[model samples]
Target: MKINVVKGTRDLGPKETARFQEIIDKLDSISYFYCFTEVTLPIIEHAQLYKRSVGETSDIVRKEMYAFEDKGKRLLVLRPEFTASIVRTFVNNKIHALIDLPFKVHYHGPIFRYERPQAGRYRQFYQYGVESIGVNSPLIDAEVITYGYAALSFIGIENVILKINTLGDDDSRNKYREIISEYFQKHIHKMCHDCNERLQTNPLRILDCKIPSDQEIIKKAPKIHDYLSLASRERFNEVTKLLDQSDIPFEIDQTLVRGLDYYSEIVFEYHYYSDEGKTLGALGAGGHYSHLVKELGGPDLPGVGLSFGVDRLVEVLKEIEEDDNEEDYNSFVLFYLIPVGDVKIEDVYDVLMELRKQGGYSYDMYHEKKPLKTLIQKAKKRDARFLIFIGEDELKNNTLTIKNMKTEEQMVVNRQDAKQVIRSLFFSSMREG
Candidate 1:
């Protein structure tokens, strides 16, 4: 018998894992700059959590959720997305009562869904997102959008177009839903079976359908902007106005209702195109929700959030990096020590301890009794900036021989002053860079 990874999931080896970490680190830094505290949520929750927050009409609850009954015969589910769970955490912990209004939080973790894997998509994929709970303002909405845009920019993902739409307030959304329902009902017979099902539940989801045949009818359907209430329209104008003041480019996509039911106003997606001009769709998306916290048995607190498909972002970034010939900074070795000629580990243990004490540097040593040529080759593969040779002559002289791999320069320095010399060299390289 043989064992293999389950379908729709795969392992991330060294390189991929490093890339994932690098991305997470960048996101974490940006989130911190924006004053977002990090929080970890459980992967499992009651099945009703998603159903109540995400809505049973959405595809995630209806089809994609990894739902099962626990040993207690109580229904449980792997979280399909983060917002619902985050809201549950907020309510259950009473964070809103403890913290100030608009409690901001950021999170990154694995999300489970049972959909067929596609390009840049997985049934078990990671998500990076932020939630601003307890407040609902146009400025906060714009700020969340700007934060996501800034995060992607900091991650080196270029040419992202912000596609935005307004779902309006509850009353406006209800009115539009009723109007769109009538329009889709007239053509429901000609639409896909899923679209027919959506018509009975959420008519806005019909706009999210990808079937080519259904698109023509969907395009002909009523636009939400036409029915937006005065307040909803003003709120949207304020958001767009703030974005304009920030000089962030965007497009008003009236057709983009997003896939979730919790979204009520100002939904947006960050879209990107490949080098070949093929659309990769949304790298990330989010929107404002008015009733989720209240619906989850908490106070009537509105919130806004955004989430990036980290798996898709990683794949897209790999392609872009390959084209740009980006450097692998993760594998860079600041100092690589190679013991030349019959050098025992015990002989140079003190020097190794000194290097370890030099807190800000990354160094490694070759302990195997291999040829000097082989050792140098290994150092080159690790992209060592400086090569340190430890042998009998240097040990006797109480000196260290250092070679700059980039400049091909060599120098011998007193072991006591080696740290100073290396620090100078490192700073020089930084200045040059």
Candidate 2:
């Protein structure tokens, strides 16, 4: 019997895995450019970590998280997001007192959420993100958001628009929440059940509802800007100003109340637009969370963060890569080995290893002998630029036949110099780059 993969999960085949790795490599390089160090976090955490940081009313906590009691009778959850886990780490390790200020770290891993899966979404998904703690400056908020934009740009994603908003500080939020509550109360009966509950609980969430009718009602609701305290408004304006000075384009979106409860002050999301008119939801989002660290048992340090949906970003990257000019992905392989006639592959294994030691991307077939036509087809399929044939004749003659798949040119060289020629080709490509 064949065992099928779970409904919302998949095994990425070889090519797809390579493609994902390529995207991640680009992101890592960009992270270095932004001076964000790397950190790792566990996938499982005490359930309270999220409930406290994400809030009980948020959809992730109330309806989506995969929480269960372990054999120890302790409640644990497969992390639905990274911010809380990272914060917990920060607190438990006493990273605040031990490390320098503004401890910025980037992480990449899988996150689980028991939700209805759709295109570019799954119950188990991957995320890449950064958290900057111990700093409350609007400048840091702008900095992290710009880093996110730059990372996507480096990956060749096009037509990306940054949508930003301000949730204001605590006092500003309280005043705005009261106004929002009062406005939504009158239409409580007409709104969806979730929206009505949110009205009395966290009315800010109503703006995020997907129901068309509810969205229409939310549009007329009071905007956060109307109630932002002087300090809150100024802080927000400064963030936008910094982004503008940095030449990062963005627009203020007052209704963009991110779903997470920990976020406040400057909130931003990255949206990618395809020329084909396909809409891939927010590629990534983040905002200031001045109270989360304190609330989660850490020192009263201000923090801001953002996470990109790796699955969604990969989808976007694939689309962009597909539409790009073919020349962008030149078909070239470092080396491909073929065994001709009755010659055993074992006889040529040492040569293959030598090529690998020289840092060439070399591959060989399992079969000891195969038809030249079949071997040539395999070479073409793998995009092998240099094809080397191993046969009794060449082995005895101490000579090698190298074929350039690109130009269909062939050359014979002494067997001992094959590695040198291969290294030369590799170095030539590097020099051209």
lDDT of 2 by residue, 16-105 (tens): 666678878898998899889999888898899989999998989999999999999999999899998888888888998887788889
The positional error of residue 67 in candidate 2, measured at the CA in angstroms, is: 1.9
Model 2 reaches what TM-score against the true structure?
A: 0.92
The residue-by-residue lDDT of candidate 1 on 52-138, one tens digit each, is 999988999999999999899999999899999889999999988898889899999999999988888889999999999998799
TM-score of every model? 0.90, 0.92
Worst 10 residues of 1 by lDDT: 323-332
Minimum summed lDDT over a 10-residue window in model 2 is located at 323-332
| lDDT, residue 163, candidate 1 | 96
- Please list the C-alpha lDDT of all candidates, in the order they appear: 0.90, 0.84
